[model samples]
Target chain A: MAPQDDNVDAVEEAMVAEVEKKPIATIVIIIAMQTEALPLVNKFQLIEDHDSVFPKGVPWVRYHGTYKDLFINIIWPGKDAVLGVDSVGTVSASLVTYASIQALQPDLIINAGTAGGFKAKGANIGDVVMVSDVAFHDRRIPIPVFDQYGIGARRTFSTPKLVKELDLKVGKLSTGDSLDMSPQDEAAINANDATVKDMEGAAVAYVADLLSVPAIFIKAVTDIVDGDKPTAEEFLQNLVAVTAALDQAVTKAVDFISGKCLSEL
Target chain B: MAPQDDNVDAVEEAMVAEVEKKPIATIVIIIAMQTEALPLVNKFQLIEDHDSVFPKGVPWVRYHGTYKDLFINIIWPGKDAVLGVDSVGTVSASLVTYASIQALQPDLIINAGTAGGFKAKGANIGDVVMVSDVAFHDRRIPIPVFDQYGIGARRTFSTPKLVKELDLKVGKLSTGDSLDMSPQDEAAINANDATVKDMEGAAVAYVADLLSVPAIFIKAVTDIVDGDKPTAEEFLQNLVAVTAALDQAVTKAVDFISGKCLSEL
Candidate 1:
């Protein structure tokens, strides 16, 4: 595992994508980050960095970058809770934004970032957790099985075969944004039985379900979501420890993505 | 069946939907020609007319109009493929857009329109059939079990529960603007085991799945997809008997929608 290198910047510089064959593989990865997504990988290798593969800042809409064998591009939509390019009509805009970055047409998307852990007996600090099922914990509609939010009598979340194939630890994930983090938040969080919490994972997961693409959402438990009373600063302060887990997780993810792509071949 | 005061202006007056809170239930009717839509049955009505809705020519968009207890919308995505809006995304936009207009949240969305039937021994000119399954046949990658597009395998499709509940004659409908009008197209259409073809049904189904709302798409067969060897206009003209069938099919759909809504309440 190496650190972010000065020469690695050059390695990123040389990466070029040919439109002749947009890498629409059977497998793809979509990594979402609450803070910085770099540290999760124990081995940080520079695969390819391009001038404009994806999107950039507030004014600039796209940034194109790739790492390891993964043709990675980042679009910071800057929206607080869920941020993906807002598209017109009924299309998956995030997936579209992802597809428009033509270096790799990914079949799977991995949403990796940090989350506030539930701090239950089963979950602990710095544990890398996998969201086995993702859903809007707050959504309540009483259908036949009485499913509401992520807690349903029948089934509350979306769990695909990919989750089983990866052999990752499954935890319930909150799909909606934390608009109001009140005292009763834990009571609601406890109901879903999640290992951690974050905003972007579920949004990405929802799109992946529609695309029928395999998605792996990795969240390093940052703050104990239940300990004391959780706040934004408390979550941000623990960013480094979480990033350390991100480094190894990301490395494993890169390997996983490469294997997935090669398997389809 | 009586007309809605026939011999009056053919094109509708406004595009914005009229409210339908708890309206009387009615049968679905398909008047092939727009002029005949409202005139076929005094009970038969036009939900939305494209000419009047997007009078300014809003391409790649559909407008939904709801009448009390009954909901209707008009959709025409530029008559071909190479779209400005992705199908699923735009349908969500239409659902949300028209939902606001309707004021009355609909129990379900019944898409009423005409479609082309895939050539088969049993299927013939003007056969009135209900879509058993709707899929984007054009969007597929070869897999082990079969060729799937997105749902589970490369040959993914969306089937409405209502189709089976009502016991409507099953028909296959394919989405995407690339109408396979050539004789060579038979092999591929048969690959999915579909009997009918259309452009927007799957998109609507996907959105309905996402919102967890029930949706029924009723398409009247207007032409046949032999292959690209034949032009679209050439094939549509071949189906002369479909005229009356189209009207009957549409009428059934509307009635089915009405019954489904009232029964739920």
Candidate 2:
């Protein structure tokens, strides 16, 4: 009986090791702004895809390289070549995410960017949050059942192991096209129970869900939504600081996922 | 030389007849709500794709059939199954349009829906206007060069021949997630020179352009943005009437396009 028990233990340990070694090989990180993408791209030493991996005339930029045992690509919807604005809304986010998935065929997606946080939700200037859920705050379809549809609530890929391992803050994220929130948006955000809000997370989540791809949102708080200062002023002032914070958090997350399967994360 | 010239003319006439008979084949009409989709679906006698031509578990609906010489499909973002709310915004519009293009490989796309028209732009309720250009009104990123990017302006397919033949009013269409306009939205809409505004038009245009599919927008005016009544009230009151108008206009457009090439349109 003692010998049999020892043999069983050894077999179980071997199976666990085999599962741990099955890595999430390919990962696509979707960032809406060049400023936000630059740090992660540099940190990963990803080279720009100069041959125009995306559609030829569109401004979508892709940077890719192998980091550790993982094949990583960071995609920026890219500045509108003519307008020079970082394409920073759900429309651009969904398009780029869909394009990246179709081209790269990644096993996992990471939507990393800057977002405004709510102080009432215990957020600070430079905190990185692992978004647990995402919803829309500005799509106010007022019809009977459409009120909920307008919210477009979606659960992000579950990453309890990563959250716990990284000691990251977790919160619900709300998305909208506007930087400033209206009264209606505020009500919707409250309904969503969102602690953080951004221009692109939920849209990315929606695309990922549609494709049946696993996605995680890692957002750094750049401004306080409930704070007294104007949103634009606070957002600009804190963006640089939060980008650094975001970079560090995402780097940790990637490292943690290096040799692990999505189930382990 | 005269006999040879007559032979060349005969060959040319045969070529012309062959080209005219080639047919546009598959066309996709993207509508945001079931209310907008029902009339077109019924008019065309399109059969609902209950087996899910779209991805399983998504709320997107597809109805397809042949009309005259054209194979037509009508797609609605569909109500959230659980919430029972119509998915009526840019995010849903983009997703469904992208999915439809991937699945159907449409030769041309028609975005037919109802919109809020402006008295300032000489819009009358029930008037169906062919959108010449489409832009976003609510993506107000006020950065130096990003201002133009935020507007996300795109030209609809060139349909000067169709417009002249059909005697339809042509105007620019603006889009936003919200049914109600913000002051900022007003400024952007003015900048766009938009006569009509809706939740889904530009998003559909964006996806269509990305895929190199020619798309036409035929929006029926449902509410006057500058009118005395509130937007929601006016929208609800006029939705049924405008749906009929939208159906009639779309039917005419479809009939006109039955045996024409995209270039001919």
Candidate 3:
């Protein structure tokens, strides 16, 4: 072979070797609150890296660690969309998710949290729902233009094999900034056929889609969407139970990624 | 009186004179879009101060000028909450509003924009509505601790006498991140007796309230909330008409402030 051909072969071999040497998989798990993230933190024994700094005045909390050949990061975006007390609504989630994606360049993103389920759709308290698709029930941009804006249905797929192995319920989830739903909203939610609802999922999914990363949502049902009691009352009462379910689902998800998805990769 | 008393009296009079010499009123008008702010910008002949920089990477547009005895500043927080394409949700609004408040220290803030109004509540396209109270319909915490968090029923009063003089409709306005609403949401909104619905109003009001400044919302109806057509189509089609109404409403609000509210102050 010519000298140049020999050189090219050597370069290609080095590139392949370099690729193989990199971490097998990196997963970024973004949780909205610390309570929702505690299970994963404890389970993984993730350490809070005090050396890392967020932008000045940003209130988010973050933790990270390596677990069995996989790198995992958890960020609790400080602002709440529903209360409008601390952070801007979907904007904070989008920006933080985007920044997290940019910073970590993860292979997968998992948004783990608690949600209110629709009883009419067989969603009950403490049930873990694996989100297959997400749409914004509250995003009511008027018709013909809504499709053009491309904000109508933001869809994300989970690892179907993992879903089957875990025996998870795959369903659609709706996201909005409101915490309490009026009777009319309940009717609309029922019509949408969403099994669960939360505030941050669509925004996170939208960011993941933008970055060409696979994203999955694992939400524990904390309350009934159409319960007779106020949402705040229900959420407080069931947070513990829901969080326990969330803990199990997250562990399963991590196991699936490490055992199944990473081996394939 | 002694010589010290006379000297103190002179200083007191000078201090009062200095206070009187400052601008009588400073008004910060925060609009969510450039389109919503254009009329006020043109009417006031606001010049873009290129030298005044926002914190790096904040997706907000700014303009400022003096009109009559009032210093008027306009800010356009780019994009909506649904897409999460730019900036974090209410965080952006809160941060930008907070920064603007710190920089300008305006005596009053007016959130002027367009909204989806409920026709059942006597709303029509291009009609102006003055907001007296605001709430978050989507902030469902579902916990008994919610009231302690106090994320509900944020109330802001317009200059009551000025509101009366302007002949504006005083009613509640609901704010959320979603640009679209479901049928059930529409019914719930109607039930809440909210005259108008829009994004960013509550966050802005929340910030203003935190800063101990009075705020008012002046919204021009761009579309009917429960109209047969989609909201995006309606918003686009009626942009011009709605903007015209917004322009008129803003002008009247400014007049009330300069001619009536400021005089009271």
User: Which ranges of candidate 1 are over 4 A from the true structure?
Assistant: A1-34, A38-69, A79-104, A142-169, A179-187, A261-265, B1-265
- Full-model lDDT for every candidate: 0.44, 0.86, 0.70
Comparing to the true complex, what docking class would candidate 3 get?
incorrect
Q: Is candidate 2 or 3 superior in lDDT?
A: 2
- Residues A61-152 of candidate 3 have per-residue lDDT tens digits of 56889887688888776543344343423545665676677568787788888898988788889889898888666554334443323334
Q: How does the DockQ of candidate 2 come out?
A: 0.29
Give me the candidate number with maximum lDDT. 2
lDDT of 2 by residue, A5-61 (tens): 888779977875664457799999999888889989989999999896666456789
- Which candidate model has the greater lDDT, 1 or 3? 3
Location of the lowest summed lDDT over 10 successive residues in candidate 3 chain B: B80-89
lDDT of 2 by residue, B155-225 (tens): 88888888987788899999998888777678789989999999999999887886777899999999999
Off by over 4 Å in 2: A1-23, A49-57, A103-105, A228-230, B1-23, B49-54
- What tier of docking accuracy does candidate 2 attain? acceptable
Ranking by TM-score: 2, 3, 1
Worst 10 residues of 1 chain A by lDDT: A81-90
